[model samples]
Target: MSERTRYEANVCVLLHRAGRWLLAVRSPGVAYAPGQVGLIGGHVEPVVGPDVFETTARREVAEETGLDLAGVDLHYLSSELYLGDAGQPVLTVTYMGELADGIEPRVAAPDELSAVGWWSLAELSTVENCAPWVPPLIADAERLLRRR
Candidate 1:
């Protein structure tokens, strides 16, 4: 049998005022379960002379959450590995960005996003069944908070 290729992607976890971080609830009807909160990001598309983070950050943010990155400061958060079916590995490059002008997350794609909102890092930590990928992301957020 031949080996399968692993996918690499970059993610941006948008944080808003009052220490609230953005989350997208995965829609239930899809292959993955619905109502699962996750950071906003997608694959890092190839572009001329573009770094992994720069190329995907703005586009991924627009795709996942309908918020624009105008004047927002994007900070490198952390990177972690996520598993796919058959134990395949996917690397997620995560970041934290503050809202520039008090805009909120809207449903850019209703089918893919059942709901979107901001929650405190503490609240997110307390979520009973947050996705397996969240703890590391939260740790990254805490680190960012400390530096502030």
Candidate 2:
């Protein structure tokens, strides 16, 4: 038998508005898929806390997009296995979140994120060359929104 593939837990945050959402442009130098547009999130650290999902979600948004969890209405969406190069799996726990007014993210960490901005679902559908796994995750989120 061949070596089993490895998977790591990650967090995904959906910042949504009136039928729109936020997407971040990943830095071009990251070992992972670089220069791809994706939801704001990252690996879930083991020490994140008892509420690991929430902690990681909050931390990820802060790290990548500078969005604090304050007043952000968040709901658990789904867990998905995202296949990257060499079939490496990033098992992501996703959340559907709505941001409150009077808050926005800047390029606080240039090394990790090149840019961040909001986009409508229709606009996202037309974004060329997004990370391969992102489209599926967005579809799932859209379905979840419809049910809500």
Candidate 3:
């Protein structure tokens, strides 16, 4: 018998403001990436409704950060594959957007996140215990920023 390959579609938002990006610390109790810093995102819930990747990105950001992206212009950043906590393959679509002036993120989902804050590229690179993909994502984000 062969093992079945499982896959999941997820969307993440790299919320930027004043040269900083918003990041969330996953709660220890969470199933994926527990206690690691990562972008605001989650698996697309097809049961609730079918949505475009951008809508899923926006929804996940709001659900995790309490920040409204109603008027914000989100740009497609990049996409990559990684293993989930359960070791299932995950395809993640990433979007970048600038938050409204003076807006900040809070822990909207305590059960999912332990903390939320803004981090600069340097900080992101040097920070210990960040999600393994985060450093490379930061580089991608920097390239995207340079293109703008």
Candidate 4:
């Protein structure tokens, strides 16, 4: 049999403000996790050169949530492999960071996201239609936040 396709690299940002985490509602037309609450992020573009994971995370957060992570300290949270909607393997790198003071999230990319909101850990866990990766990522983010 032919070799399996290489896994796509993606990055996710768990943006925290006060005691809440930022989550986006995926656009209904999106290929992965459509209509579900999920972290703000997207695929790492190959053309972006080295250190693209963090670059992509920053870009995606701005694109999807209209928030700037410029001076925020992004702490690496975790990484995992999961299948995308197209049945391709994706290696997702997750990062956690605090939202800069006085900034609020809005749905910046209407085609990619429908809404943006901040949720506490308990609130996030109670969301019924969240993406599968959300729960674990939230737990990881909680630990990271605690140490801050």
Candidate 5:
């Protein structure tokens, strides 16, 4: 057999409540993009039962921020392929979710994130160290949200 490449599959979640984005600021200790404002998500776990992307989005949100997304509606925004720090091919899928009326987000994983809060795009623009890809994701999410 010929050689084949292996890629890591990851999922990212963007949550919005009344046109405000639920954003996370990564801690300075992370291996990738530390101290940046980015979406909340992680690698997809190997599970048999639920949708892997959705499951990962939910799990990551719960782990990174003390927020349960069980009741929120999740919409797939986009998928991207990029090179990781280790020169591995990485496939990242992004999901957009709308936060429930009364639900709130908190920084649950101190080691992974420094802060978690809701902000408007205008407000988010002023945040330092925001990820470069974050604006594109937000645009995609807003476009999708308008279709709903």
Candidate 6:
């Protein structure tokens, strides 16, 4: 890795309702993490100025899931920095918020996602069904929620 290598930044937000969490299946063409059940998020683009992270979270969540997160305050859960499968540094900031009582996520970006569904928290005990990075963030959300 070059000392001057720039890391790509992405935001991931988890929404939980009725003991199930929202996730999407990546279509086989994305540059990273394709074809795995992963969070509802995307890269942090520079359009949203001061609140870059939060804005990116809102945009990605809406664009990818068709869920209008307007006024849904996102709380930070965790972050991880590591080399992607392509050996480039990727930084993912994880956030969590409750899925509103009656609202649900749908597949809004057909090209980027193949399907969208909720996964049982219990079913996620094993990592086979999701990206390797998912479990820890979910654990962090659970831990923090427990403390509330």
lDDT string, candidate 5, 38-78, tens digits? 98999987778858888888999999998888778898889
Question: Alpha-carbon error at 33 in model 3, in Å?
Answer: 1.6
lDDT digits (tens) for residues 1-148 of candidate 6: 6679798999988988776788888988977677888888988885746878888888898899899988787899888898887899999898888887878788899899988888876677764758876777777788888897
What lDDT would candidate 6 get against the real structure? 0.83
TM-score of 4: 0.88
lDDT of each: 0.71, 0.80, 0.85, 0.85, 0.87, 0.83
Evaluated against the true structure, the overall lDDT of model 1 is 0.71
Q: Candidate 4: worst 10 consecutive residues by lDDT?
A: 139-148
Q: Worst 10-residue stretch by lDDT in candidate 2?
A: 129-138
**Could you give candidate 3's per-residue lDDT for residues 1-148 as a string of tens digits?**
9989867999988988888888999999987678999989887876655557888888888888887789999988898888867787999899988887778789999999999998888887788878877878877887888887
Kindly report which residue pairs in candidate 4 clash with one another.
none
The backbone clash count of each candidate, in order, is 1, 0, 0, 0, 0, 0
Comparing 4 with 5 on lDDT, the higher-scoring candidate is 5
What does candidate 1's lDDT look like per residue over 1-148, in tens digits?
Answer: 9977867555555565666777778777767656778777667765657466755877777776777775777777777777766686777777776675457778797778888887776787777657866766766677767788
Off by over 4 Å in 4: 1-5, 85-87
Where is model 1 more than 4 Å wrong at Cα?
1-6
lDDT of 1 at 130: 71
Compose the digit string of candidate 2's lDDT tens values, residues 29-146. 9876688888888887878348888888988888777777877778998887767666778788889887765678877678988999887766767888577667677777888878
Runs of candidate 2 with Cα error greater than 4 angstroms are 1-7, 82-89
What TM-score would candidate 3 get against the native?
Answer: 0.86
Per-model TM values vs. the true structure: 0.80, 0.83, 0.86, 0.88, 0.93, 0.87
**Model 3 misses residue 75 by how many Å?**
1.0
The top-ranked prediction according to lDDT is: 5
Residue 114 of candidate 4: its Cα lDDT? 89
